[model samples]
Target: MPVYKAPVEDTLFVLKDVLGIEKFNNLPGFADATGDMVDAIVGEAAKLAEEVLFPVNLSGDQEGCTRHDDGSVTTPKGFKEAYQTYREGGWIGLSVPEEFGGQGLPYVLHTAVGEYMSSANMALTMYPGLTSGAIAAILVHGSDEQKSTYLPKMVEGTWTGTMNLTEPHCGTDLGMLRTKAAPQPDGSYKISGQKIFISAGEHDMSENIIHLVLARIEGAPEGTKGISLFIVPKFILNADGTPGTRNGVSCGAIEHKMGIHGNATCVLNYDEATGYLIGAENKGLAAMFVMMNEARLGVGLQGLAISETAYQNAANYARERIQGRALTGPKAPDKKADPIIVHADIRRALLQMRAINEAGRAFSLYSALQSDIAHRSADPAERQKADDILSIMTPVLKGVMTDRGFENAVAAQQVYGGHGYIEEHGMSQYVRDARIAMIYEGANGVQAMDLVGRKLAANGGRAVMAVFKEIGDFCEENRADERLAPFTKALKKGLNDLQAATMWFMQNAMAKPDNAGAGATDYMHLFGLVIQGYMWGRTVKAVHALQDAGDSRTEFLANKLVTARFFMERLMPETALRKARIETGCDTVMALDAAAF
Candidate 1:
């Protein structure tokens, strides 16, 4: 069975040391988010995750979710109750606006909570995870009436939300989606479409399901420019803010997926459903991005969460699973064999997971901090800069963290050897569960394209240059820190490599579009690794500073330094390979004829 102990100490290090949660407490609406309150919140969330949710993780996978013929869905046993517990505990509104019955906590702290929830049970967590994204969208783009109608219910967990963008023939190509929405005399539109791969689309965990759907208005221009967003509820709300009659929405079927079985992936059919327009007509794609950006970050946290959980399980197993004698010699002569952790190779795997997980945690928190800055900054320039950096980092977090996260899961499973392959051991599930993170919420490939093709070139490359400057300043600040000297040097080298790769793409993209396409994925990973290296260095500096000040948890702070070194030595080296591939240009990728293979 899978066992999860929340890494609360490490979480605090990232929050207080790396991202400065103390400063966040001084922000508007965050006066109550003091250190003690933050700790209490995380403590409760961890307890719920480990005690309430972790126990059912394996069972959820085994039972999966069931779909009824009447178009309703049933989550695994204990999921409904677990969701209720999550709501009653105020977890659902951790970072929501205060006007909507939320605690209004900073996202930096909520990032830790998100990681814990996902680690406990990603499958069940998706139900609320997606709801959070939907609620965030309405909070940002929905009209006041729309917000009044949905945000409270969503924040209260009485009504959950789903995002419907994918169709049978369209995955990443939203421009090709065929869903249609027609304006009616009542001002509300009538929506008709079939959407696939809708997570939490028809779950029984909430009283109402609100779907933020993308469709093209009638007589609108073709392709993406004509697309519009609509709010389609499973059941319409009455005058008193309660679910009234059933809407013309039904689940046709559910997909049998590789993982996240506790959450339903439904094929939803909307037939003349009453839909309210969100934002302006012909601007649906832009509106959907509000939710997408939030979901992308959440998905990134999914990556970090799974990696942390997998590493803990693997580390615990390593210490207890005694096998061969130590390579240096028999260290446990009285026992049958020494623990696997004594082996250098086993240590390598564990250390790699540790380094990546720690760095990933810091990176996610840093990104969340940027989000808070973008949302709450008093200065327009500060907010714009934050938004630019956040936009560029979002794809990196989603793509690289998830890809590395899946790798860490595989590494953790490898530590288990034969035992990892068996389902009953619960090690294999990590790998299975981690695989979908790469595919969903925009595939890592799509994320890479967005990074290199769109974000890097946006605002005439100002965004990319701004990010480079930030990294450069960090390197300069930490160049003198003896403990972080090596980390700073490695970060500088990685940043140079990223810049070189970007220049190569910028020069060649116009001549050969395939050059960008070919180099997009690897380049994204390269950029992510470099940024993560920078984050690790920052974390090391913060932790060392705290240690110098005679703080408690010196051992934990020391571990941060060690992990920073490990990440710089092991994980950051992958950037060299990616650079070589990007510098090779599009020759190999575009060389083959259509039918050559």
Candidate 2:
């Protein structure tokens, strides 16, 4: 069985030392996220993850979700119960609105709790995770009546949610979607469509499934401009708003996917399902984006969560499993060979994984803080600034984090040698589960293009510049700190590399669009490296502060310092290679004629 101990200590450190989350007391829920409150909340979340979810993870993978002849799906054993425990504990409403029957906590707290659940059982986590994102969309776009009718039950976890944007014909390009919504006399539409790859689409855990779907109204304009969002439920509500009659919706079939078998990815058939428009006509994409952004950030958290779990299991095996002798000599002379951790090569792999995981956590939490500010800050300027940062970083967070996160999973698997490949050892499951995050929530390639194409040019590049400016300012301020000089220096180098790539795209990609398309992925990765590098720099500052204050966590602090150094010295140099590839542009990429193949 795989082991999962939530990184509560690390989370607490980042919360207090790095983010200083308590200082945001002026914000509505910020005051409650005090040291004790955070500890109590996250500590309980950890137990739930470890005790309830973690045990079922491997079983969930093995048993998978079962789809019956009737099209109803049954989650793997223990998944439903785990979700019940989760909802009863008020986990679903951790950051939801108090008006919606929630605890009204800061979003950051929910994010931390999410990380624990994800690390423990990603497939099971999707049930509530998708609900949270759907709730975010309805809360933003829904009318007062709509909010009152849906938000309370969804918040309380009596109902779960799913986003149904993809059709048989399209995934990312909403313009090509063929789903249709026809207007009715009672101000509701009859939605008739088939949406594929709908996660949590037919799960039995919830009493009702609220689908935030995208479709075009009759005679609407062509392409994305005509797209509209609708609230469609599996069962229509009665006068008391309880689920009464079955709607014209059913799971045509659940997809046999590569991973995440515990969550039913369904092909949903809506034969004129009763639906209500949430936002304006021909404006579905705008409303859907609210859910998309929320889901994107959540996916980024998935990346880090998987990586953290993989690292923990791999590190445990390295210490306990007997392996080849150390390059220096056998440290465990009594045994036949030293543990693999003593080998420099093994150390290199483990250290790099640890370095990236640590920094990625910081980046994610910082982004979450920005989200909190954007959503809750009293000052419009503060909110806008935070929103700008969040907008630019969302794609970066999803794309780069998942890309490296999958790499980390593979690295963890490699640590176990042949045992990793076999199913019983459980490493293969991590790799399989981590792979979906990159493809969904907008694939990493689309993410990179968005970074270069839309986001870079959004608001005349204010958001991207805001992120760069923050990193630049951090690098400059810490340049002279003796303890942090190495990190600051390397971070500056990566920052320069990212800037050069951005500037190159500005000069070249505009003239030839393929230039941006060809190099988008590289630029995104390069940008991620610098952002994570800056995360390390900030973390070093925090750790050094603790060290100076006579804190007793000497070994922990030392390990963190080592990880920071590894990130700067050994890992930060990849920016150069990525920058070189970015400058090469689309010459060779588009050289081949269509007939050549």
Candidate 3:
């Protein structure tokens, strides 16, 4: 069985030492997130993940989920009880506004804890993860009544939520969607549509499911401009805000997916379901993007979560499983043979995953802090800058994290040799589960295009420019510090590669659109390398500071410094390759004829 222990101490280091989260105490929830409070929250979440969630991961995957004749779905064994524990603990509402029956903490806390939950059991965590996204959308776009009716229960974990966008004929192209909503006399619409690939769509865990669906109103304009968002519930609400009559919605079938089998990915059929519009007419796509953006970040974290879990199991196995003797000689002369970890190749693979996982965690928390500042800061300029950074980094986070995360999972599996491929060790599950993060929440390809196509040009390139300047300034400020020179120097080199690729896109992509399409993925990864490199620089500085002050975490600090150095030496150089690919443009890529295949 696979084991998972939340990186609580590492998270605290990132939160308190590197990011200095306490600096934002003036912000509403950050004030309450003292050292003790943050420690308590993260430590408790770690206990739940290790004790409650990880135990059921393998069994849940084996049992999967079952759909009954009555169109009701049941999660695997122990899931309901686990969910109940999660609800009673007020974990789902950790960062929600207090008005919505939540603790009203900074979103960074929720995000930090979220990695543990996802790593423990990704399928189970999706139950509340999707709900959090829906709550964020409703908070921003829903009416006063909608918020009052839905926010509290969803926040309290009684009622869960799902975003309904894709249909039988559409996945990314919302304009081609065929779902329709007809206006009624009572100010509600009759929604008739079928949405597929709806995660946590129907389940027995929650009292009701609120689906934020996109549909076209009768006689509305064509294409995406006509699409509008609607709140369609499984059970219609009564005057007292309780679930009353059953609505015209049911699970048509549950999808048999490759992984995350514990989540009820349902084909939901809506037969004239009573629906209320959330946002303005012909503006549903914009509102739905809110959920997608949140989900994209969550998906990126899933990549890291799977990588972390897989790495742990692989590392543990490497230390215990006896393999060939070390190249030099017998490291364990008394034993039958030396442990796999004694080999240089094994250590290289482990360090590769370790290096990325550490820097990836820092990047995730740092990006999350940007979200907190973007939403909570009092100054408009601060908010704008934070939002810009978040916007530009979102695609990079989603695209590069998952891409590399899946790679790390495979690498972890490779560490176990033949044993990794077998189901008993549970490494296969990690690889299968990590695969979906790259495809969902907008495929990595779309994320890449969004980065190069829309995000780079937004507001005359202000966001990307701001990020570039931040990295450049960090390098300039830290050039003289000998302890930090290695990280900053590598980061500066990576930043130069990323900037050169961006310039290539600006100069070449416009003349030939195929150039943008051909090179977008490389550009996205190039961007990710620099961002992660920048995070490593900060991590090294923080570790050095802690060591200088004799913080007493001698071994942990030493390992972190080594990992940061590994990242700089081994991974940061990939930016040059990505930049080279981007500069190659699309001539050969697009040269193939339609009949070439």
Model 1 TM: 0.98
Error of 2 at 350 (Å): 0.7
lDDT of 1: 0.89
lDDT digits (tens) for residues 1-597 of candidate 2: 679999998998888888889889999988877789899999999999999999999999999987898888899999999999999999999998899998889998998889999999999999999999999999999999999999999999999999999988899888999999999999999999899999999988999999999999999999999999999998999999999999998998989888888889999999999999998999999999999999999999999999999999999999998878987788999999888889888889999889988888888998999999999999999999999999989999999889888999999999999999999999999999999999998999999999899999889889988888998999888777887888898999999999999999999988899999999999999989998998898899999999999999899899999899988899899999999999999999999998997
When sorted by TM-score, best at the front, the candidate numbers are 3, 2, 1
Residue clash pairs of candidate 3: none
The deviation in Å at residue 576 for candidate 2 is: 1.2
lDDT of 1 by residue, 1-597 (tens): 778999898888788768786775546655778889889988888999988888888999999889887988898999998889888887888988889988888877788888999999999888888888999888878999999889988998989999999999999999999989999998999999899999999988899999999999999999999999999999998999899999999999989889888889999999999999999999999989999999999999998999999999899999999999997899899999999999999999999888888888888988998898889778789889988999999999999889988999999999999999999988788898999999988999899999988999899988889899999999998778877788899999999899999989988887888888989999999998988898887887887788888998877777777778888888888888999998888888878899998
| Backbone Cα, N, C clashes tallied per candidate | 0, 0, 0
What TM-score would every model get versus the actual structure? 0.98, 0.99, 0.99
Alpha-carbon deviation at 195 in model 2, angstroms: 0.7
lDDT of model 1, residue 490:
92
